[model samples]
Target: MTHEVTDNRQNDSTLASSAFEHQMFKESTATRTSETEMDIRDRLTIKGGHVEGQEQVFTEGAMSLLELLCKQFASQVPQLLSNRVKKQALIDAGELPNFLPQTRAIRDGDWQIRGIPQDLTDRRVEITGPVERKMIINALNANVKVFMADFEDSLAPSWNKVVEGQINLRDAVRGEIEYTSPETGKHYRLNDSPAVLICRVRGLHLLEKHVEFDASSIPASLFDFALYFYNNYRQLLTKGSGPYFYLPKLESHEEARWWAKVFAFVEDRFCLQPGTIKCTCLIETLPAVFEMEEILYELRSNIVALNCGRWDYIFSYIKTLKNHPDRILPDRQAVTMDKSFLSAYSRLLVKTCHKRGALAMGGMAAFIPAKESEMNREVLEKVRRDKELEARNGHDGTWVAHPGLADTAMGIFNEYIGEDHVNQLHITRDVDAPIHARDLLLPCEGERSEAGMRVNIRIALQYIESWINGNGCVPIYGLMEDAATAEISRTSIWQWIKHEQKLSNGALVTNVLFKEMLVEELANVKLEVGAERFTHGSFTQAAVLLEKITTSDELVDFLTLPGYEMLTGQFG
Candidate 1:
């Protein structure tokens, strides 16, 4: 069956009333500077202002690809993003998301994805991190099946960091990537047989604030994707691999259709086959969960799997259902995969993907092993149980943040999916009572605690502080906290404040209560990190921003949106 790129939501009531337009970003702080590479194209301009290696990555050829991508598909992004607001408005009004009746035929139809590349079949233990040089060398050399070099959640997109990442990835692709630490003089390089490489671009909501087309900021996804694909596709193809990707934060199948169109356009431009550019979409948002089969059906030509981005899923649950007071979540710690809502999501995703003959990858194990042996054992055991749950529930693979946790995750998958099989595709979870909307939307049972609330405030403050200082992935309290997890932390506090939920200690979660805790937490964090580091760090601004968002009348869409505004002004 040949699947075509089509807009199936034309007559839908939830369509965004406004169309995307090209206009200068009023809030963008990027200033244009006269440089040699700046004259490459009149229509395309780089406003990032003089990085060391800007000339190498921003060549005319690369800029042309970025321009072409912006011209073709960037306009569609705003409308899709607007559709998210419209959908949330409906949920806020009264309606909750359910399976699309219009697309029931496609969901019930017999279909499978076109083909899977040989290199992508056995993705049992994948490690994901920022696109730093030493990280690229270390992750690729680690004993895992894949290393997803991320330009999204784990990366703080300073202009220099963004450009340098592309250069690092380019060299890594050619087996020439090397890093010598400035402080320690230790060198790093890729191993002979490195794990397969994949890139995760930023989401649709974010813009590459440093790049402009027709005086408007271009979609960061397009910028990241077009540059990487244009520069690396030929070399990758020659090496028997294709441009594999992990599409993040897709809320609907219409968004998936948009991506399929992009794949088709780029493949045709390069004279490659339809399935030459493959991707795995993360079912991170709550709306995407209901549209799993439709999403697979939309991108069947190029999609290989669907991953459970559990942290963001929880965050979305709070955001999408913010108006529904009855569904207010308790503690972030209490909302585990064993909860009804998360369990239903996992089982339904496994069933949907396996039914389509695609892989179902599990969520991340974000524990950073402690230095103490007993504490480290507890961390490994926690990760082991998590991976075992996914493996037994028919997940083909799982994610790990640290190299130390890969062995434990790999062992769990190996126990279920032994030497013979590449994945757990044979374990199709077909049961009598199929997973339904209520099952996926069931209210989680847990207790709200004063201690949990305090922890959330501290984590969010520290993570946001690190993020603005050009570090996105932070290890705080022994866990690798990324934007997704940090999002949950802050949003949970906002939700508690919004609903005035009562904690187990008999204290009401009022704005006054939150402010009290924020002050206490800031002092505690300052004491823990030392006065020298705390005084020089971005903690003050982080606290101020945290207080504003948590105490405001409405919850902010994303902390990164505001955090990015701060980051641009300080970009070096």
Candidate 2:
């Protein structure tokens, strides 16, 4: 049983009733909400998690499609999530991940993913941001090859944000998205030929509280994907493009197989072509890293590229290997791309993707150029170097958090890959990446610093305050930090404390030491943000939230889970 919240409690009244067009939900969604269909009659119900502000987005058509999906697929979630626990138990007992034996035949087999749309071929410099209306408009207008309307990490899944994002993407696909900032009065709109749109839905682990059936919440991944596909797929096809996606937080080949089934289901239901929807898989989790080739194999009809999600990769690394005392990671800053594990991972990605004739994308440079200054210049330079490394290592394209970074990154790739839309050079043909597991699993070693400790705590606390306050991507101390980076921050601290890590200054990471440092960092952060912002920022609640999640007896699978409960005030 999950905790549910309902409003109005008014009999025969519509969810979004006040002065709308014939009360859309009242006419359609309200009837379906409590109906007992033969397939899902006694199995589940939409009992809880009704979002208030944008209830009308759940119209008859959208909910009808959602209902069909829920009836067919919602019951399978527990089994899939359970597979994670069951697999982790094996890892807990000392089993490690490798290329799947069952999928070895598929790996050895020579098959390529279905041909992608022309616009999706050269994704050399894709800009990524949340699904806010202004971000949607600006990112598409930015001079990048692709703009991923991210509903996963960069956007907090507030009810309003989710529904509004659907409307925004609809408008974007129709070439009608525009925004005028209320404060600055600056207008935002798409260019004559905007960047290609790719939607990244929420991960498998998250559930949509606002939609439910069969006594369980609908998977947020499904809600985000289905709605966008239903609304915009046909229109995108008309414009010589199609619905593209970036899949996040996949943990295993088994999970990838499930996603393949999902794409199949949607295509079948919509009567679209065999491979209408193409996806780029994010290899962030440790298990996902091991199963990259297999993931592409499973979605051979749909997966177009593979990306190294560096920040979440770090978070997953810390969480996965926390039980092994010797494998405790160094400070986040010290773990550069040159670190054996990351190097192996990046090269392996290129190797795997190229060998199978797919694009191998690179990680992000989160440093933001918020203003024109010497500091901003240095930050852009760092971003250039980072993107250069990826290009030299044979990445087809890379991610830029800001539009300004697109040119530099695109230029470097263009130099290597030429005027070609996508990089045709598979430079790593002779290189067998991560020839051994140690190449991707080396124990990181370096002198840990109290400065590092303070920084992690500070970042985690700051990001959480914004996240719970309904901002997912926030500029703090220089760079754009999101849920992924914040996950790394808190998880690193948690792993450090659990392992009793020693700092360069000779202090041990004990409970008392952490508490004292947390207090000092909180005060310093307050002062940094100043009185007015700090008071409104939820610093007190942020501090408590971080402490609770990080210092818990067991590691939390995802920080957003607990953080979301706090945001919605609903939990099982």
Candidate 3:
């Protein structure tokens, strides 16, 4: 049933001469002038839903012309017909279905199913810490949706560390493992927790043998490495489900398609279903942006989510727009909330994913700190505002880097979930309080050199009192309604109280307890001096004693009393 075409003509002149004569015999059937030609619309015949002599006839005639053209071309390209016949025979025998059934649920829209497609929001944060059993348990207890056991960016790229990271992940996911600190040699046994475990394999483009790396031969492929990990750790996956992965630095739709095909092969070899292994594409490159729809479409719905990779996105933009002076973005540090182009692109991604009913998640808050110092608190405030904006614009979730930052991030989501506030208020006050000169009250110069410190201390104390009473809101220094500030104070106070309680109950205090106690003491005080004072070791011992005493309501009341100024001066 199959015949192969043989080209006997060796020279172009022989083929052109034979084909040229055949082309000359073709008829020109439309010599009639437009004025004398019959209108095809006038000769229409009703056949089913089609107009026979009108649209249908023209369409059928066009199809016939296409077939004739194809036949003529087939003579020149003989392999085309043979391939078509073979494909048709396979279809007729039911060897392949005409269409693949959609296994993953997706909202109806055009989507690229492959590559590192960007998240709906261009901001993403990832959390990375020592692979301890307690750290894993904390992540599970927290409200984070995508907990990535990072091996690429977070961990050191040493071979031994990589193997250790894999082992830690496998044990954590299986709920049957203990982790030992490589440095401290401390052991931690893990407990059952339900956090989703996602891992980032090494970057494909950075592999040793890739051309970009100037290698003589291709290094081991990240794709192969991922398969190796999955095969070895298959037993530890939830209910024997294969390990899930997030592919980083994917450049093209073809690359995504190739990975999808590779995954298909892996699944078949392991006797697993096509979608048993889920993937999240990290959209970090510019080319991936253009082909996003196609990439998502090709993946056929096994995608868990897309991440907005901030650091990589910025780096990629710099590289792509380097030659074009007009398109060059501002310095990375200068690229903040004011950038219109970044906002527009982010919104476009959100709209695209929402249209397809996929989760358009926000980016990470990686640089935010966990401590309760002024600078760290300010960073958390800004991060909360940014994440709230992302959620309002339709992101399903955002990332948190530190455990201390998790509560703050979650509080931002909880407050902004259904509320509509165009601009988030960093410090909100009662709406009924009209602005006045008194509202801007400033401390008289030299009246009390530490007046600002005193005000801060008062606000901190009020926060503790409200927390002790189980009230969500607390009045701070007669102004500024701050839920986040109150939360931080409460968490610090509780941490200190719990540690002290455990110590008094005859439990030995550990390094963690001592560290938290030190942090809590610092959080409760307001020093006028900066880091220089700490570096010089010149802090007054009285400040530490005062902080310890202020932990109780009676002490707070005494400090805030009308005559407390004399008491503080005497103590100093």
> Clashes in each model (backbone N, CA, C under 3 Å)?
0, 4, 21
For model 1, state the Cα shift of residue 399 in Å: 0.2
* lDDT (CA) per prediction: 0.87, 0.79, 0.43
Candidate 2, which ten residues in sequence have the lowest lDDT sum?
3-12
lDDT of candidate 3 at residue 114, scale 0 to 100 = 25
Ranking by lDDT: 1, 2, 3
lDDT of 3 by residue, 1-572 (tens): 22121222223343334333333343244355343122322222211222212231234433232232222221222242244345435633434212122422222333433222222112233344434346666665555544666544443233333334445565566676565788999876643545556666655533212111111222223422442344333443324333567777665555666557656654453444345455767776544554454455555435655666654554444333322323333222344432554454455456545444344556656554634588777777877787777766555567776656777766666565534521222212223233222221111111111222233334444443332222223334322222223222222232233334233244433334434544554544434334554444312333333355434332121112222222223321
* TM-score between candidate 1 and the true structure: 0.93
> Residue 244 deviation, candidate 2, in Å?
1.3
Root-mean-square deviation (CA) per prediction: 8.3, 8.9, 28.6
Task: Pick out the ten consecutive residues of candidate 3 with the lowest summed lDDT.
Answer: 440-449
lDDT string for model 1 (328-389, tens) is 89899999999989999999999999888789999999999999999999999999889988
Top candidate when judged by TM-score against the true structure: 1
Give the per-residue lDDT digits (tens) of candidate 2, residues 203-307: 989988866666567899888887887777656766667778999999887788888888888776555556767899999998888888788878888888999
Q: List candidate 1 stretches off by more than 4 Å.
A: 1-41
